[model samples]
Target: SDLPLLCQHFINNYNQENGTTVKGISNETLQLLTTYHWPGNVRELNIAIERACIDARKGIITVDNLLRFTQNVSRQNISSENYRGFDIKEARKEAEKAVIIRALKASNNNRRKAAELMEISRSALYNKIIELEID
Candidate 1:
């Protein structure tokens, strides 16, 4: 769709501006960007793609390059969930669990790396992994 083409254009333009060799975006990367709900709209997408291109360094942009932006979008979606009768403590726990899961996934299930990403101690992450019953 237009999203992919837009991303491609942005990548091309960014390369030209930076004097870097133009690199292509993988279909997977385009799919990831297209599927995301851009809370900040085109401007945000433009910035994210620009950052992704810089991070990619003339290599194909991959989903990894878009992780931070996608994570922000996902967090916004989670925050919009209806908690109904849930107390503040319960909501906090839910949010914590979600963040822990994301950290784990982002770190490829490496507990140490996940803890570092969360800025928590390794033991704390292990404790949460047990407390949250995260699979």
Candidate 2:
């Protein structure tokens, strides 16, 4: 967010004062970064800024730093982005069934009370169990 950019600027200023001459960020990089949706958030920005600072020499921070960050984290989190080509519908149904079963167990098989706790209608809960064929 705004905090990471401010921190990066501050780091740049520190480098400037110490005569190290950190490269200024580019407009194109800023444009894409601002437009893109960053779900993982400011931590990703911090890594990017660090990489940029490390690679800077002639006063221009290229997009290469950002590319390096993506390449590094992509390998670590490929599973989160893809379900390994499994059927999404089946996975979702399985998850819904698991939730209902857990709710029933947590409420000691009291269907009405489980419905209230789950914020779902009792009729809907009954329909789901019947559809899933859970005893």
Candidate 3:
């Protein structure tokens, strides 16, 4: 609703202002944002957005950037040292996959409801599950 409109606005201005043509993070970022149950609420989103914008030197926000925020939102600070013992990238992906599945289940598999529960858009959630290679 209001949130999609808001992100859309960000997408438009961000491209114009940065001249980098990177699509706004909404496609993937919104799914990450909306599916979290938003216990911490919009303040959390603001902080995440600020961070993404700060990191966007090229204008594009990759899935990697969103993944960083995802990890942050989950507070999974498994520490770089411990992750060295295992395939850290795979481990993180697995953990993130679990989080999305749990969120979907909590919302009864209704992607829209799940997105709302996560504070994201229905379409964004669908796109992300595919993008993340989540079954």
Best by TM-score: 1
Per-residue CA lDDT of candidate 3, range 1-135, in tens? 455566556656655676645556635546445544545566655555544664554665544454444546543322221133455455455655655676688788877877775566778778879967877
lDDT tens per residue, model 2, 92-113: 4554565667678879999998
Least accurate stretch of 10 residues (summed lDDT) in model 3?
75-84
Candidate 3, overall lDDT? 0.56
Candidate order by decreasing TM-score? 1, 3, 2
Misplaced by over 4 Å in model 2 are: 1-10, 13-19, 72-135
What TM-score fits each model?
A: 0.53, 0.39, 0.40
Model 3: lDDT of residue 16 = 66
Give the alpha-carbon lDDT of every model: 0.68, 0.58, 0.56
Query: Tell me, what's the RMSD of every candidate?
Result: 8.1, 15.5, 14.7
Model 2 scores a TM of 0.39
In candidate 2, which residue pairs clash?
Answer: none
Query: Which 10-residue span in candidate 1 carries the lowest summed lDDT?
Result: 74-83
Taking all chains together, the TM-score of candidate 3 against the true structure is 0.40
- Number of clashing residue pairs in every model? 0, 0, 5
CA deviation > 4 Å runs, candidate 1: 68-71, 74-135
Give the C-alpha miss distance for residue 106 in model 2, angstroms.
57
Flag the better candidate by TM-score, 1 or 3. 1
